[model samples]
Target: MTILIPSYEPDQRLIGLIHKLKEVSGDPILIVDDGSGDDYRGIFDTAKNAGCTVLTHRTNQGKGRALKTGFDYVREHGIKDDIVCADSDGQHLPGDILKITEAIRRHRNHIVLGSRQFTGKVPLRSRIGNSATRMVYAMATGKPVQDTQTGLRGYSSEMLDWLCQVQGDRFEYEMNMLLEAPKAGYDLYEVPIETVYLDDNKSSHFRPLADSAKVYFPFLKFCASSGFAAVLDFALLFLLQWMFGSLFLSVIGARLCSSIFNYTVNRKIVFAGRAQTTARTSIPKYFSLAVAIVLLNYGLLHLFHVNVGIPLFGSKLITEISLFLLSFWVQLKLIFKSA
Candidate 1:
C-alpha cells in the first residue's frame, strides 16, 4: 500500500509522524506540500530525507486539490498499489491507517474509512460538527456514515480517476466524494479507530461558514428550488380557491403550474443529472414524480385542513414542510439520480 499525506503550514509534529510511519510500514509515502511556504521547507526537506516522495504546490489550493495532486502522481507513474490517505496533523494514528488499508484490500472497490467513536475528551467543535454533518449526510444519501469528516481513508488504484473527478476544492470535496459514490456503484466500509484531537484540533484548517455551506450545497440548492416553487404554489392555490370556490380544482391547478417551474429549475440546475440524462428521457420521469407528489400533497393538505381542523393557509404550510424531504429524496434518487 502507498500512503498519501497532504499538508499545509506543517510543523515538527509532521516530521515526527513521518519518522514514526517509517517504523510502522515500509510502504512508499507521498507528501504534497500545499504551499506551506519557505518557513516549512526544513520540515519538508527532513521528510524527503526520510525517504518520502515530496510533491509541492506553488500556492495553497486546498486539501481536495492537494489530495488530487498526490493521486495524479500515483496514476501517472502507473502505481498499482492501493492507497491510504491520512492526515498529517497527528490526528490519524499509523495503526488506524494500516487498518483502513487492510479493509481496502478486502473490499477493493469500496472506500474504506477509519471511523472514530469520538470517545473521551473531545473538542466541542469536532463533536458538534461531526454530528451535524453525519445527520445531514445520512438523510441526503439514505445511509449512515459514522465520521463524515474523517481524513483516514483508503481506495484501490482503480478509483484514482473517479476520485480526481469528484467535486469540491476544499473540505467540501470530501463530502462530495461520499455523495457521488453510490451513484457510481461504490459502497463504503468503516473500520473503528481511535479519535485523538491534539490541542483540541487546533491544526485543522476547516472554515466553519464557507466549507460547511459547500458541504451542504446540494441540499441547500434543492431547498432554494423548492422554496421558490412553494411560494408560487401557495399564491396560486389561494387565488384559484377564491375564484372557483373549490379546493380540489385550486390544488390541482396550482400544482400544475408549480411542478412545471420546479421541474425546469431542478432538471436544469439542482441535481445536474448524469451526462446521459437528457430532456427527452428526464421529462416523463419527472412529470410522473410530480404527479405523485401532487396527489400526496393534496391528501396531506385535506387531512390537515378538513380532518385535523387547521385553516387552509396554515394547512398549506404544514403540508409543504412535511413533504419537503421526501420530495427532495425522490427527485434525487429517482428523477434526477446519477446512474
Candidate 2:
C-alpha cells in the first residue's frame, strides 16, 4: 500500500505522524510538500530519514495540488492496491489509517472515508462549518455524511488515475469529487473512526467560512436549481389537482416533472461537464433509480399520511428525510457507475 501525505510547512506533528505510520504499516509513504518555504526542508529531510518518499513543490500550491502530485507520483511509479490519503496535521489517527486501508481492500474500488463522529471537545467553527457542508452534501447527493470536511480518505488503485483527472486548485477538489463520484461509477463508504480535535482544534489551516463556501458553493448552485424546479412542480400540481380533483395523481405528476428538470439541470449545469458519461447511457439507469425512489418515497408518504395522519406536505417532507440513505446508495450505484 502507498500512503500519501500532503504537507505544507509541517512541523513536529507531521514527523510524529510519519513515524507512527511507518511503525504500523510497511507501505511506502510519500510526502508531497505543498510549496512550503525553504525553512521546512528540515521537516522533509526528517521524513526522508524515516524512509518516506518526498516530493516538493517549488512554491506553495494548495492541498488539492499536493494531493494531485501524490496521485501522479503513485501512478507514474505503478504502485497498485494500497493507497490512503491522510492529513499531516495529526488529527486522523494511525490506527484509523490501518482501518481505512482495510476498508479499501474490502471495497476494492470504492472511496472510503474515515468518518468522524461529531462529539467531544469539538471546535465551534469546525462544528458549524462541517454541519453546514454535510447538509449541503446531503441535499446535493441525497447522502448524509457527518464528516464532509475530513481529509482522511482512502482510495483503491483503480481510483488513482481517476482522481488525478479532477480539476480543483484548492479545498473544493474533494467536495467536487464527492459530488462527481456517484456520477462516475464509484462507490462511497464511510468507515467509522475516532476523531481527535487537538488544541481545541486549532492546529490546521482550514479557513472556516471561506473554505466552507469553497466546498459547498457547488451544492448551493444545485440547490437553487432544485428549488426552482420544486416551485414549478408544486404550482403545476396545484393547478392540475384543482382542475381534475385527483390529489394523488397531481402530486405524483408534479414531483416527477420537477425531478426530471432537477436531474437534467444537475447533470448539465451543476456537474458542469465533469461527469464523463453521456445521458444516452446514464438516462435509462437514472430513470430506473428514480422510479425506485418514487416508489419508496410515495410508500413512505402514504404510510405517514394515511396511517399516521400526517398532512400530505408534512408526510412528503418527512419521507424525503427517511429515504435519504436509500436514495444515496442507489444514486451512488446507478448514477456514479461507469457505463
Candidate 3:
C-alpha cells in the first residue's frame, strides 16, 4: 500500500512521521509540498534524501487539492495498491496508520477510517468542534460516524477517480466524502485509534468559523429552504381557509403552491439534484410524497384541532415539526440521491 501525506509549512515532526512510516512499510511514500515555499525546501530535500517522492505546488493549495495531486500521481505511475492518507502534524500514530492500512487490506471494498475516541485530555476547541460536527453529520446523513474530522483514512485504489471528483478544496472535502459515501455505494468501516493532541492542535490549518460553515452548508441550506416553504404553506392555508371555509380545498391549494416551490429549491439548491437527477423521475416521486404528507397532515390537524380541541395554529405547528425530520431524510436518501 502507498502512504500519502499532504503537508504545508510543516515542521520537523513531518520528517519524523516519514521515518516512522518507513520502518513499518517500504512501500513508496508520497508527500505533497503544498506551497511550503523556499524556506521549507531544505526539509523537503531531507525527506527526499531519506527516500520519498515529493510533489510540489507553486503556492499553498488546500489539503483536498494536495491529496488529489498525490492521487493523480499514483494513478499516472500505475500504483495499484490501496492508499492510506494520514496527517503530517504528528497527530496520527504510526501504529494507527498501519492499522488503517491493514483494515483496508482486509476490507478491500470499504473505506477505512482511523477513528479516535475523544475521551481524555482533549483540547476545548477540538472537543467542541468535533461534537458539533458529529451531531450535524448524523442529522444530515443519518449515519452515526463517531469522528467526522479524523484525518487518517484508507481508500481502495479503485476509489482514486471518485476521490478526485469529490467536491471542496479544503476541510469541507473530507465532510463531503462521508456525506456522499452512501450515495456513491461505498460502506465505511471505522478502526479505533489513539488520540494525540500536541499544543492544543496548533499545527492544524483549519479555520473554525469559515470551514465549519462550508462543512455544514448542505444541511443549513436544506433547513433554510424548508423553513421558508413551510411559512408560505401556512400563510396560504390560513388565507384560503378563511376565504373558502373548506378545509380540504384550502389544504390542497396551499400544498400545491408550496410543494412546487419546495421541490424546485430543494432539487436545485439544497441537494443539488438537478445535475444528477431528472425531473421526470424525481417529480413523480416528490408529488407522491407530497400527496401522502398532505393527507397525513390534514388527518393530524383534524384530530388535534377538531377532535382534541386544540387551537388550529398549535395543531399545525405540532404536525409540521413532527414531520420535518422525516421529510429531510426521505428527500436526502430517496428523492435527491446523488447520481
Candidate 4:
C-alpha cells in the first residue's frame, strides 16, 4: 500500500509524523504540497529528503483536490498499489494507518475507514462537529458511519478513478464519497482507531461555517427543492380546500400537481448524476412511490387532523415529516439507483 498525505501550510508535526510513519511502516509515502508556498518549503524539503515523493500545487486547492492530485499521479504512473490516505496534522497514528491498510487488503472492494471512537479528552469542536455530521450523514444516506470526517481512509487501486470523479473540492468531497459509495456498489467497513487530538486540534484548517455548509449542501439541496415544492403544495391544498370544501380532493389534487413539479426537478437536476435510470424506468417507479406516499400522507393527515384533533396545517406538516425519510430512501435506493 502507498501512503498519501495532503499537506497545506503544514508545521513541524508533519515531519514528526513522517518520521513516525517510517519507523512503523515501509510503504512509500506520496505528499502533495497543495501550494503550501515557500515558507513551508523547508518542511516539505525535509520530508523529501527523508524519502517521500512530493507533488506541489501552483496554488492551494482544497484537501479533496490534493488527494485527487495524488491519485492522478498514481494512475498516470500505472501503479497498481492500493492507497491509504491519512491526515498530516498528526491526528492519525501510523499503527491505525496500517490497520486501515490491512482492512483494505482484506476487503479490497470496500472503503476502509480508520474511525476514532472519540474517547478521552475530546475537543468541543471536534466532538460536536463529528456528531452533527454523523447524524446528518445517517439521515441523508440511511448509513450510520462512525466517523464521517475522518481523513484516515483506504482505497484500492481499482477505486482510484471513481474516487477522483467524486464531487466536491474540499471537505465536502469526503462526505460525497460516503454518500455515493452505497449507490456505486461499494461497502464501508470501519476500523476503530485511537483518538488523538494534538493541542486541542488547533492545527485544523477547517473553516467550520463555510466547510460545514458545503459538506451538508447535498442534503440541504434536496431539502430546498422539496421545501419549495412543499410551499406550492401548501398553497394549493389550502386554496383547493377553501374552494371545494373537501379535504380528500384538496390533498390529492395539490399532491398531484406538486409531485409532477418535484419529479421534473429531481430527475433532471437533484438526483441526476448518482444514477442513470432513464425516464421510462424512473417515471413509473417515482409515480408509484408518489402515489403510495400520497395515500399514506392522506391517511396520516386524516388521523392527525380529524381523529387526533390537530389543525389541518399542523397535520400536513406532520405527514410530510413522517414520509420524508421513506421518500428519500425509496428514491435513492430504487428509483434513482445505480445500474
How far is 34's C-alpha from truth in model 2 (Å)?
Answer: 0.2
What is the C-alpha local distance difference test score of each model?
Answer: 0.89, 0.81, 0.89, 0.90
Query: What is the C-alpha lDDT profile of model 2 across 276-302, one tens digit per residue?
Result: 567887678777877887788878888
Of the candidates numbered 3 and 4, which has the greater lDDT value? 4
Candidate 3: pairs in clash: none
* Winner of 2 and 4 under TM-score: 4
Model 4 lDDT per residue over 228-327, tens place = 8999999999999999999999999998898888888877777777668888999999999977997998899999999999999999998888799678
Ten-residue stretch with the least lDDT total in model 2: 330-339
Q: Report the poorest 10 consecutive residues by lDDT, candidate 3.
A: 269-278
Clashing pairs in 4: none
What is candidate 3's local distance difference test score? Answer: 0.89
Query: How does model 2 fare in lDDT?
Result: 0.81
Best by lDDT: 4
RMSD of 1: 3.4
lDDT of 1 by residue, 267-290 (tens): 888877442477788889888876
Model 3 error, position 332 (Å): 0.9
- Candidate 3 residue 297 Cα shift, in angstroms, is 6.3
Q: Candidate 3: misplaced stretches above 4 Å?
A: 231-255, 273-277, 288-322
Estimate the TM-score for candidate 4. Answer: 0.87
